[model samples]
Target: MHLVIGGAYQGKLEYAKEKFNIKDEDVFTCTESGDLPQGSKCLYRLELFTLSCVRRGIDPCGAFSDIGAWSGCVIICEDIFCGVVPLDPLAREWREATGRLLNKLSPEACSVTRIFCGIPQKLK
Candidate 1:
């Protein structure tokens, strides 16, 4: 499974659909009220609240990263949350989680993955 996570209106879902050719029916919007869709191997709009605690430096009891590890899913978390100040506890936690996930996935991949922080169009 390939996960693409982002805030509302960030185009993460759209990019996944377009870039990966995923159908609408294949997308599962994880929410407190909605049950996980049947046979939906892919999750689309995962509730931000599920991961919001990490932003506050409080880790969620069971996070998607844990699920991803078990399921061998590739997760792409984009602009999930950003901090105004450098060296913030929340920022450190986020970085640590990301690093752990990446290391778990492939520790030998030494190439740097550049993260562009700018207007989306600037990517082109």
Candidate 2:
């Protein structure tokens, strides 16, 4: 599976559709709400839901695992940083969350990949 990610308005979804020759229905948009740009298959608003759960200290591992299982084409958009930050607490937490989710779904057959717009940063 391919994970296409970008900031808001970066055109990642459009790029994916064009590059892969996939129709709007073939792509799944996982955003804040069930609503998405017209002509998209927004199955689940995972970002908002996950943020809500995480903020409340609720375990979202199961949700991430489920998404991994069900999604063959995913687009993770908004809120992802693309710079070499001077490491801070919030960044650390984000890294931890990303790591935990990846670990939980590591064995899944899908090919996990990330697409970012702009100059790539070394995420050491």
Candidate 3:
């Protein structure tokens, strides 16, 4: 599995697409109301999926494990835990949840890349 992370609007999705050679049709945009298509080669906006799971009273990490197990899957998520701590309780919770999910995925991922200014830096 591959995990790509960076700040919002940092070109993580484009980097993942180029790096993985995934076509548009094979990419899954993970959103609150959307479901992951079975055997999707790529998943983007996973931070929202995690937040949605939190709001729905579900364990986001556990829910993600199944998707993460897919061979050759590429996951793209924003690195939202940086900078000042959020004042809102729900915002704080979402930040923590995103961090935990990233931690859980990093070790298992065959490759992890951090993108900044359209540049890719391999982390693992």
Candidate 4:
């Protein structure tokens, strides 16, 4: 599996598409409907997915575990734990859970990259 992480608008999705040769149609963005695309090689905005899971009262870790089972999948999410901590409980929980999920998923990933200023730096 591959993990691409960065702050919002840092071009993580563009990096994944260029590097993986993934077409726009193949990329799946998490939504309130919770309709994840099965068999997709790339999944983006996992931070939003974490928030969606929290809003639905679902365990984000478990959700990530289930998604991570798809080997060779490219996961894109923002590093949400940085900057000012949210005053709202739900927002805080989402940030913390996203960090935890990334921690759990990164070790299992064959490659991990962090993007900044549209440049990707490999971490694993």
In candidate 2, stretches whose alpha carbon ends up further than 4 angstroms from where it belongs are 20-22, 25-46, 66-68, 77-95, 102-109, 116-124
Model 3, 1-124: lDDT tens digits are: 8999999999999988898999998888988754556677988999888888778767778766674456678999999977799888878888888899889888889999999999999899
lDDT of 1 by residue, 10-96 (tens): 666666666557777766665433333334545544443333545544443345434443253223444444545446765566555
In angstroms, how far off is 33's CA in candidate 4? 4.1
- How far in Å is the alpha carbon of 10 misplaced in model 2? 3.3
RMSD, model 1, all Cα superposed? 6.7
**How accurate locally, in lDDT, is each candidate?**
0.45, 0.47, 0.85, 0.85
Predicted candidate 4 versus true structure: per-residue lDDT over 30-108, tens digit per residue = 8754845656788898888888888888877775556546676898989887789899998988888788889988888
What is candidate 1's CA lDDT for residue 115?
Answer: 34
Rank ordering of all candidates by TM-score, starting from the highest:
4, 3, 2, 1
> Which window of ten consecutive residues has the lowest lDDT sum in model 2?
36-45
After superposing candidate 3, which stretches have Cα over 4 Å from the reference? none
- For all the candidates, what are their Cα RMSDs to the real structure? 6.7, 6.2, 1.5, 1.5
Estimate TM-scores for all models: 0.44, 0.49, 0.92, 0.92
Question: In candidate 1, where is summed lDDT lowest over 10 consecutive residues?
Answer: 110-119
Model 1, position 5: C-alpha lDDT score: 42
Indicate whether candidate 1 or candidate 4 has the larger TM-score.
4
